[model samples]
Target: MRRSPFTTLGGSGFDGSQDAEARLRWFEHVMRRDMDAPVRRLSRMVSGEVEDVIACDVVNPDHIDVEFDSIGGLESIKQALYELVILPMRRPELFSHGKLLGPQKGVLLYGPPGTGKTMLAKAIAKESGAVFINVRISNLMSKWFGDAQKLVAAVFSLAHKLQPAIIFIDEVDSFLGQRKTSDHEALTNMKTEFMALWDGFTTDQNARVMVLAATNRPSELDEAILRRLPQAFEIGFPDRKERAEILKVILSGEKVEDNIDYDRIASLCDGYTGSDLFELCKKAAYFPIRDLLNDEKSGKPSKEPRPLSESDLEKVIATSKKTQVAANEYNSLRSQLVGLSRQTETDDYPVQAAISELSKLVVSQILNLQAENQDS
Candidate 1:
């Protein structure tokens, strides 16, 4: 007969004591493989090659030199950010060392695309003098089974080491989507690990690590993730007055005609986002250059190009279009945010009033713009 591997060292036969030892050994082996292996992987990831990982992901403050004033429009959002992020960072002594008042651990910036979400995040880091880590979700994805989770853990660990860091995840919905059974196991595990690390931020009163995320589709994010981000703000389309300010800011550096009719341009671009406005200005300015190039091609080149004219802008406006956000889609996003604001209410971030005011403003502005477009 073939003998089993389990054999008593003290005697010839395998007995109950030997069987118990063998069972204990097998249990330890399983635990190490299933439990301890993950811990070791996490440890190694956190401790080893951290600098290299951070170098790839972390954006230095010098690289993000945009000041708060540089971002035109959204004055109320800026003030809210001052109270939520900048104030605490400015007076870190008051927030550190087990004080009752603590800085917000995370903030979420959500709104329509091209409204300067990334710029706003950079401005906060610039204002606070914090290291900004731009975390790309695609970079964290791994082909191996559990490597992505390990990478997520490693990111938090690196942030802890580099204190006073702002980890900005632009378009965060793709990274922390609503959890479901059909979701890939790797992605789900990565999100869980990221959340666990985020929860730890509360335990450290002076960690100086804030998570800032921006997304156009806030409803697609996981509820657990939203709960962690206590501070939230909506960066909506600039109103007509704000649009004029943005126009002046964009044209401030350019040599343009004295009578450019900025207010008229702003009114005409009622639905345009800040980015749309910039592109419009560029195209309008190009009309003068195009004229100069045509003159040169006809062998009647003028040495000096004419200043940008109202007629040039008007011509562009005639053909140019505003990036109108869909009425139902904008309303749906606003409603979702209003509901989420109510559901995730906490003392640290009382965003209900802000959300209510923003919702009303967004609805009014978008409706007015839509009415204008329809009338025209």
Candidate 2:
């Protein structure tokens, strides 16, 4: 057997040993790169999944107890929560002695996007005087099977340690899905782990922890999980009134036009969701500011601050209503408006009243009514 020399290179040239080592290093690097492919893919999928903490956590327990004056909508859900869930928690001894089934371990918030589901969850946390653990499903999910479950368990365990806490999971349907029972081993495992975590949380007398899962997709959740959840907070899209309130809340600080009528805007935005309302307000605020900035450069008084003109708002509201209206509503309205031609012949009225209350009808409807008068 020949003994190999362990020698250092006198120059940059590679000896057999050096070449072999280099090749080995390259092979190792290649293996590492190949093995890392799946991990990289998973990391990409899991990236940017943590939710920002709101002002309602264990650190600020009093915040939840104090009334949140900002959430103008969700009155029904809030009342239901206050009557059924919150009041019970206030009198724990009534349940600690096993009077009631203990406070609900979970509250699910389900609704369309932009209806302030997350905000409602925050308000609940603030009201409940509990520690708030805001979790994003992406933050827990991992390439390694069971890793997601472990994170979930850890969250519950920590929440339990800090009792009277609420775990708010946003977009929870991404993971806590309806069990398909085939091919999706990862999803199944996650659901099982979540359920186990939930059981552990509720089983304890000291576990004053409340689990809150929010999703736009309520129907997509597992029926079993839904069954277990004590209460489901139905966070529907903001109605016209709620949307108007949200708009007011957002636009409170901005300079609005005197001609801009909030009632009219609300009427026009009847079908707009809260999110759509938020965007509309943002645009309303931004356009004025941008226009003002341009006007300033030209030595003008920002065109009287362009107070959210009625036309500007109406156009925005009309665009939003077109999209926000339910398909059924849009179809129904479209049928009535089709082939409608208007002749706003005031003479047809014989004598004009101060104003026609029903002039608020769509132009198409007005034209149809006017045409009827002409024929008569």
Go through the candidates in order and give each one's C-alpha lDDT. 0.74, 0.60
Candidate 1 residue spans exceeding 4 A from truth: 1-47, 97-100, 325-376
How many steric clashes between backbone atoms does each model show?
Answer: 0, 4
RMSD of each: 17.8, 18.0
Error of 2 at 256 (Å): 3.4
Choose the strongest candidate by lDDT.
Answer: 1
TM-score of 1: 0.72
Tens-place lDDT per residue, model 1, 269-349, is: 888888888887888898788889999999994778878887877776676556664556667868876776678647444
TM, every model? 0.72, 0.63
- Among all windows of 10 consecutive residues in model 1, the one with the lowest summed lDDT is 3-12
- Worst ten-residue run, lDDT, model 2? 47-56
